[model samples]
Target chain A: MKKKLIVKKNFLMSLFAVILGLIAGAILMFVTGSNPIEGFYYLFRGGLMNIERIGNSLATATPLIFAGLSVAFAFKTGLFNIGGAGQMLIGGLCATAVGLTFDWPKPILLTVIIIAAMIGGALWGALPGLLKARFNVHEVVATIMMNWIAYWTVFYLVPLYLKGPFLETESQRIPMAASLKVSWLTSLFSGSYINLGIFLAIIFVAITAFILERTTLGYELKAVGYNRDAAEAAGIGVNRNIVLSMAVAGALAGLGGATFYVGFASNMQIGVLPSQGFDGIAVALLGANSPWGVFAAALFFGLLHTGKGFMNAMTAIPPEIADTIIATIIYFAATSVLIERNWDKLNKFRLALRLRKSKQESLEDDSGGEQ
Target chain B: MVDLIYQLFPYAIAFTVPLLITSLGGLYSERSGVINIGLEGLMLMGMFVGALIISRTESIYPGTAIWIGLLAAMLFGAVFALLHAFACVTLNANQVISGIAINMIAAAVTVYLARLISGSGNIQIIRGLSRQTIPILSDIPILGRLLFTQTYATTWFVLLILVVATFLLYKTRFGLRLRACGEHPHAADSAGVNVYRMRYMAVIISGACAGLGGATFIVTISGEFNGTAAGLGFLALAALIFGQWKPWGILGAAFFFGFASTVANVSQVVPMLAQIPGIYLKTFPYVVTLAALVLSSKYSLAPKAIGEPYDKGKR
Candidate 1:
């Protein structure tokens, strides 16, 4: 019962953060000489106006879901994996390489591509984990360094090995057989960019939920996160769990890369770290680090992302405003500690008011009886 | 080799100055018990404001506009950092998340405004600081040629700030107090130091210095604000760690990174370096930083109470 209440409170906090974010966005719109209500109306309308748009929103959210899951998973171990971008890059590169090199049947090729991405991402994630566990190196710094290394690696490797026939900047387009899109799905969504990635995302979300809630590994990781010294004293191999958690986190992000590169995007672009990596942080924070919460948050963010361009087309507000709103939401989410404090204060104030009102009413009743 | 060294010297210094200053900014915040990963965002704010102000006023005030722009960037950057300060110091929020939020907001808002003003997400200034050789210093020997000749005024300015910062941080009572706040905030508070105020000031100073660093990049190297600092801010963070949070150490570390990056950028054209793959050169500094972290992990000189929120009631 208490756990359920805490979950509800977290949900409310997230909702409050979202509302604050929207208000901040409205203020920005107002400052920029646009009608806030009108801007938001069009933003939501643009996201939900058609089945095609909704599908696009889900497609856009596919990578975000995985990224969010990855971050959330690592956070459970008290590890900050800021190297999501690098991990994604590596994952995407591996998936792209497998897709381009092989001409196997679709199922076999896709499975190989996904596995390759997972392995690549896992290595990238595990390196920082190992460094942190063994050398006491801060994961944040290690991950960031890893990010730049991955960046330069992709910058060099893609152009040299995976370059398309004419373009020097991007990898060769994946063959149709390896793509996650299918004819039936496309037709169902009225030719939207939705693909197998969304279904993959949902499956992973459920799996992540199961692993985190029902598995011993999840308990160990959480135990370490709560108190490293205590967990160590309790015989948990804190170092091993840290490494394993990071590897798992990296695998999740790697799957995201596969879904992104092969499932959503057709080609791997060089010199660009996918922004979804950073957006994953926002999604995790707003989702309260819960798998289902992450799913819901990613979908909302996806809607904002998909709707932004349409809003820009229809209104004076720029597409960047959507990003602004999302960023503001993240900022509020980070500062939710203040809101939690204030919430308690408000509850106390209300109780005090009720108590004072009851005392006055009893005093009045006594005075009337004496009269 | 001599020719190549001479050619690369100025470019290397140009890159190092901004990084050095920014790392120093991070030094202040971290030394005051706050982890400020928002240096990147603060720097972006600096770049954007610098570009926006300079682009607007350069036509009318060609000689002085850049200075004004830089000043505005510092002001805006300091102002923007207040958000981070409020979140981390006042509200006791997660510093890392707050810093990330700062970065995201800076990136999005700057581009949003830039697109509004320029119709593209980039702002360019008409003129940037020119390299000027010091009159007396330039005639001195090889040292003069490499260090004093054809240098940016901002480079000298930043170097001066570095010296002052070193002195202020080491020689002053205020510095000691600030250091105390970071190392042991409860003790500092018991000793009559206002931990929160010191942290707020430190974070604000970090913002201002990081802002100056960003503007320095615009005036000296980039010559435009393109909505990103190209991870220079993160590199500055690495330098801060690499330097072990010391001012002079930061200078050396920043220069090392600067030199490495300059070599990577020019390696293709330099015959001596052409034999090596560019990837190695490009990733050298980051790899080196990771190695440094490993080597130094046994005896980390990090502030004792860094990243912890001060709660007077707890202790």
Candidate 2:
């Protein structure tokens, strides 16, 4: 019952944060001399107006789902994996290399590509974990350093190894044999960008949920997260768990990169770190670090991202308003403690009013009986 | 080698000043128990505001517009940091998350406003600071040629601020009280130091200094606002850590980074540096910082009570 209450409270808190974010967006619109209601109407309509648009939204959300899951998973282990951008870059690089190298059967080629991506990302992530575990180096700093290293590595490698025929900044396009997109799914979405990545995302979400709720490894990781000294006293191999957790987190993000580079986008672009990596942090926070919650939040953000372009085309509002709203939501989410305090106060006030009403009725009954 | 060093000296100093000031800003905040990762966003805000103000007033004010714009940026940055201070100090929110929020908000809002003012989402200034050599100081020796010649006015200003800040932090009662709050807030509170106030002041000062750093970048190197600081703020944060949170250490670290970056940027043209891969030079500072972190882990000088919300009722 207590667990159920906590879950319900989290849901309500998330809802409250979303509403506050929208209101902040509205205020910004108003301040900018645009009609907020009209802008919002067009925004939602653009996202859901047609089946193709819905498919596009889902496609946009595919990488976000994986990125969010990666962040949420690390968060469960009390680790902040801000190196998602670097991991994703490495993962994408690995996937691109695999896709461009071989001309094997479609199924076999894609399998190799995905595994390569995961391994690359895992190796990238484990170094920081190793540093943190052995040297007591802070993961935040290590991850950031890793990010720059990965950036420079990609910058140097892509031009030399993966460059396209003419363009110097991006990789050669992935052939259909290695891509995550299939004809049937494309036809089903009516020429939309949706691909097999969505199914993969769902499967991983379920897997993450199961592992976190029903597995011993998850329990041990959580215990260490809750209190390191206590977990050590309980004989948990804290160092091993930390490294394993980071490797797993890195794998998830690497999978996100695979979906992004081979599934959504046709080519890996150099000199750019994917913004989805940072957006994943917002998604995890707003989702309360839950797997399914991350899924839902990713979809919501995906819708906003997809619709913003249409909104910009139709109205005077710039596309950045969507970003502003998302940022505001994150800010509100960070300050949820203050919201919780107010919520409790409001509940207590309501309870006191109900008690006063009940007492008045009893007093009136007693007076009538005496008469 | 001497010729190359001479050629790069001014550029290195130009890059280092912004980082030095920004890292010192971080030092103040961390010393007061706040972990501010929002320096990047704060710098962006400063760059945008500085560009906007200078672009508007440069024609009218001629010589004084850049200074005015920098001052405005500092003011606005201080005002912006109040949100972080309120969230962390008053509401006791998670400092790291709140800092992230500050970053996101600043990035989005600044771009939104920039787009409104300029359709291209970039602000350009008509003029920027020029390098001026010191009159008497430039004729001394090799040291004078490298240090005193071709220096920006803002460089001298920032160096002066650094010295004053160092003195203020080490030699004053207020600084002692502020450092005490970061180390032991409860004890400081018992001794009549208002922890909340000190933290607020520290965070605000950080914002102002970061703003100045960003504006300095605009006037000295960039000469335009392009909605990003190219990760300089994060580099400064790394320098803060690599320096073990000391003023002199930060200066050295910042200079090391600046020199490395300048070399990387000019590697293709310089015959000696071209032999080495540009990628190595580009990644050197970050790699070295990580190594430093590993080496210094045993003697980490991070503030004792950093990133923790002070709760008087807990202990």
Single out the weakest 10-residue window by summed lDDT for candidate 2 chain A: A270-279
Candidate 2 per-residue lDDT, tens place, B1-315, comes to 898899999999999999999889888988999988888878888888889999999999999999999999888888888888898999999887788788888888888888888978999998999899999999988999999999999999999999998998889988898899888999999999999999999999999988889999999999999877778888899889888888999999999999988998888788888888878887888899999988888988888899999998888
Cα lDDT, all candidates: 0.91, 0.89
Report the first chain's TM-score for all candidates: 0.94, 0.93
Query: In DockQ terms, which candidate is top?
Result: 1
How does the DockQ of candidate 2 come out?
0.73
Best by lDDT: 1
Alpha-carbon TM-score of each model against the true structure: 0.96, 0.96
Q: Report the C-alpha lDDT of model 2 over A1-371, residue by residue, as the tens digit.
A: 97886778788999999999999999999998999998898888778889888988999899889888988988888898888888988998899899999999988998999899999888888889899899988887798788888888898898888889989988889899989899999999898889888999999999999998899999998888899999999999999999988898888889899999999998988778787887788889888899999999999998998888889889988888888888889888988999999988887899899999999999999998999
